[model samples]
Target: MGATPYSLVYGMDAVLPVELRIPSQRVMMEAGLPEFEWAQARYQELHMIDEKRLKVLYHVQRYQRLVEKAFKKKVRIRDVKKGDLVVKFDRAPVYDHRGKFRPNSLGPFIVNEVLFGKAVRLLDQNGETSTEPINLDQLKKYYA
Candidate 1:
């Protein structure tokens, strides 16, 4: 548009054929255009472009922060205590989701104490307690 408002190209740095540039530069010099005017025009144009770019960047950052906050929610894990009736996973079928779909839970076990790992001591509904510890993830707290 209107010769791109200004030409910041100096012939020395261009990869264009020398024949093409020499003739155009000679014409510009004859027209009395000063090199200083060309340099200043380039600097002003870049400043405007940079300012607009900064504003767009700032707006995008604010939107990202808002979305992150909206997606954020907290979950608190409750402590398992003694005499709590709980469900423990079956040993043979860790891959099955069918039990989770049904009421696949077994127990109403009483928690005796925590062992090493997520393992805990528990007493079954019939009063049998496991000697080996089990992970808490396999169990759910029984309300009734």
Candidate 2:
């Protein structure tokens, strides 16, 4: 028979007995084969390695879908619109030298305009618009 694909490409078995025990090892040992013969038989099984890889891929994709569904369920769709009152997250609050008890957000700013993508332009209490657009994730709706 031809060499297994793994042995052809890597010049070694895809799995070594020391790393993972072969299920047939016990049966081969009971058959009174020498240690080297048992090892050779295990190498012959490596041709099925592609099937094992496919099964792992199927499990990984299923796990990823489950995680994605959980994440999407927890995510809130922001309904931010123009003229909405919102607070911006204070990204550099630690650098302000404020105490640890200080609030981690600033401004009940007004949404002056909704920009392209998940961004918005804001107007402070003074009604002056900021020059740059802010990401929607950085702003939370202000209640009061």
* Per-model TM-score versus the true fold: 0.40, 0.66
lDDT for each of the candidates? 0.70, 0.85
Total clashing residue pairs per candidate?
Answer: 0, 0
In candidate 1, what residue range of length 10 has the lowest lDDT sum? 4-13
Off by over 4 Å in 2: 1-47, 95-98
The TM-score of candidate 2 is 0.66
lDDT of 1 by residue, 4-119 (tens): 32344542333347524333444446557687765565567668779989999999999999888877644336468777778876656566666567556677789988776667
Residue-wise lDDT of candidate 2 within 25-140, one digit each (tens)? Answer: 66666568898987887776675677788899999999999999999999999989898999999887365555787788899999999988999999999989999999999999
Q: What is the C-alpha RMSD of each candidate to the true structure, in Å?
A: 10.8, 9.3
